[model samples]
Target: DMEIKNTNTIQYRSMVDKLIFLTNIRLDIAFVVPYVSKFMQTPQQTHLWAMKGILQYI
Candidate 1:
C-alpha cells in the first residue's frame, strides 16, 4: 500500500470505519476491534494489519 498522511486519509478512514461497523455487528468474533478502534485518531500499519487479521478471522 502507498504511504499516506494520517487517519484523515481515505484508506485509513475506510479501514477503521469498516472495522468499527463489523465489530459492532460481530462483537463476539472481533472483540479486539474496540481496543484497536481506540487508535483511530492515529492508526498505524500495525492496526491495519490487526484489523485485516480480524477480518480474516471473522
Candidate 2:
C-alpha cells in the first residue's frame, strides 16, 4: 500500500459526498468517487486500501 497518508471516517464520508455532488456536473471523478463511497457505509482497513487504489486511479 502507498503510505500516502489517510483520513478519518467523518472526513472520508464528507470528501466522497462532496465528490458525489460534483459527479452531477463534473465528469472526472464521477465514476470512481461513487464506487469509493460505497465502502464508506462500512469501511474496513481493506476497504480503505481499496479506496486508496481508487484514489490513485483518479
Highest TM-score, which number? 1
How displaced is residue 58 in candidate 1, in Å?
1.5
Per-model C-alpha RMSD = 3.4, 5.6
Q: Give candidate 1's error at residue 37 in angstroms.
A: 0.8
Clashing pairs in 1: none
lDDT of 2 at 10: 58
TM-score of each: 0.61, 0.54
Candidate 2, superposed: residue stretches over 4 Å from native: 1-7, 44-58
- Per-residue lDDT of model 2, residues 1-58, tens digit only: 2333334565567767767786787787776876787877656677666656655665
Error of 1 at 33 (Å): 2.0
Question: What digit string (tens of lDDT, one per residue) describes model 1 on residues 17-43?
Answer: 787777667768566756866876777
